[model samples]
Target chain A: MERGTQPVIKARVHVGLKAGVLDPQGKAVEHSLHALGFAGVHGVRTAKSFDLVLDETDPGKARTTVEAMCQQLLANTVIETYRIDIEG
Target chain B: MERGTQPVIKARVHVGLKAGVLDPQGKAVEHSLHALGFAGVHGVRTAKSFDLVLDETDPGKARTTVEAMCQQLLANTVIETYRIDIEG
Candidate 1:
């Protein structure tokens, strides 16, 4: 909390299949929901999120680092999209 | 969309591991990030989300159904907590 000391920042990344992509897993879950008596449920899709702690002071820099991390490892941009949220 | 007909509702369920739960996978991710030179990253945690389309008109009813779905299928509540969001 002191000036010039590294600040801990929190961030969350959400990754989901891109629009127009086939989601067979989603379809299967929908069927299961219907069978379980959630009869009117449909159009099920899934996503994964990561919560991170960063030893950075600047929110901008933290977002930049996390964005790079997503690009390099977390997301498959070819068929998926991701959204990042930063919390101070 | 017609009166007396089922209305499609959008809902999202977010399931996350409870705090204090050991997250070895998160640790592994932190290590990987550090190895890749994001040295300041730590305390990484993960979660999953499901996007659902429900054929229910009432927002309250849709949320109730989604909550039940989370209990019955989407989440393992022993060590996890879930949040549900509905979009009209």
Candidate 2:
């Protein structure tokens, strides 16, 4: 399948803070959860997801493009890691 | 399995904007993609994920607990819906 004529591809990107990176937001949530009586829960990590739809049928190409997107803009690669899942 | 003695369960919560909700962030990302020559991409939506480790063994119980977490804190039910995946 060509680029424009390709099937619709969905890319789900999961961006998360790297281990040892300080996450104030996650810490705040953990505190709130504890206050709410969820003490048994710990190591709470907050992450973001991006759902992108592209007119591309090739999974490899889609992954490549979205991975670039993640590195360039979708995520801050300095202190974050991203996992991309592409499906048609 | 009992509450405190149960194995640790992982709950992945995906929170996404509800249909018909205005997504300015997604729009901004779409615009950026177009500027980057990804014109074939459209209908971008931004979302959040919460990875929680709970000291629970039963799948059903874990789901119930995480669903409550979503309703009470993790998600804004008015303009967002959350899906919880529990794993041991």
Candidate 3:
């Protein structure tokens, strides 16, 4: 399908930091959860997810396309990894 | 289990803007993707995911606790919704 065309594909991309990386934000959340009396909370790490509607129809191509988008704009490969899920 | 205890609960919380809310960042990413020649992409929305390890063991309690966390810290209820997934 062409841009703005029918049969759009919906995609979700998840990006997360690599293991062993210092996550100050996640640490802060864990601290805050503990401070708020949710003492059972620990090891909290934050990540990102993206929802994209694509004009493409084929799932394979859509996944490939989103992979490039993640590398180019959505994720930092140096310290992060991304997974893409596509749906019709 | 007590805080910092063993056999921790792993919980994932997903937070996303409400359907009608504006997503300038998603739009910007969409625009940039098109500029990068991925013309078939559209309707991009960005969301957040949090991987949390809880000291609690019971799945039910973990979900309840994470729900409270989402309400108190993880999500802005006015403009966003959160979903919690719990695992051992």
Candidate 4:
């Protein structure tokens, strides 16, 4: 409720399947690429991204905390892997 | 022409937004959580995952090569982020 107050900082986390897993969507994309006349395209894979906003004062701490969030809450280490990128 | 040859290995990639970014899908999930009477859920973020199959002889080399693939083809560092997990 203050004028001139800096709003909270936010970070975005991108999590996707690692290479080696069977990606039907990616395979479809590859097929489409060939159909679209992109002959140079040999293999294709796809991934997803997410956007998040957190209430934190420090960027470093925020990154560490977010990593923990990814490890514990967001990603499944057994099947999937994730990476976090912070932007202010 | 071999009768018993090992099948190619595959990898999966998971990409998502950072925690600070705004995620509408995550917001919807959060709302649903609250509607379902699941209190204590402050924030929710959404992300996507992909599965990939590559014909590589070495797993380590495959991971390195996939990292390059992410940096070059898969993700846009300016607005999006991504991670790679390898499986054989």
> DockQ winner among the candidates?
1
Q: Put down candidate 1 lDDT per residue, A19-87, tens digits, no spaces.
A: 989888888888888889988877789889999988888999999999999998878899999999998
Ranking by TM-score: 3, 1, 2, 4
What residue pairs are clashing in model 2?
A: none
Runs off by more than 4 Å, candidate 2: A1-6, B1-7
DockQ of predictions, in order shown:
0.88, 0.75, 0.85, 0.20
What does each candidate score in C-alpha RMSD? 2.7, 3.3, 2.6, 8.8
For model 2, how does the per-residue alpha-carbon lDDT over B4-60 read when each residue is reduced to its tens digit? 656688889989999999999999999998898778788799998888888876789
Model 1 TM-score (B-chain only):
0.90
Please give the TM-score for the first chain of candidate 4: 0.72
Model 3 scores a TM of 0.91
Tens digit of per-residue lDDT, candidate 2, span A1-88: 2345556888899999999998888889889988988877877888998888888878899899898888888999999999999875
Chain B alone, TM-score of each model?
Answer: 0.90, 0.87, 0.90, 0.72
Clashing pairs in 1: none
Superposition error at B5 for model 4 (Å): 23
Per lDDT, the best of the predicted structures is 1
Badly placed stretches (over 4 Å) of model 4 are: A1-6, B1-24, B29-88
Per-candidate local distance difference test: 0.88, 0.86, 0.87, 0.62
Report the C-alpha lDDT of model 4 over A1-88, residue by residue, as the tens digit. Answer: 1114644456777766666777677787667545654443344656655555555667787788667666765666676778888765
Better candidate number, 2 or 4, judged by DockQ: 2
Docking outcome class, model 4:
incorrect
Clashing pairs in 3: none
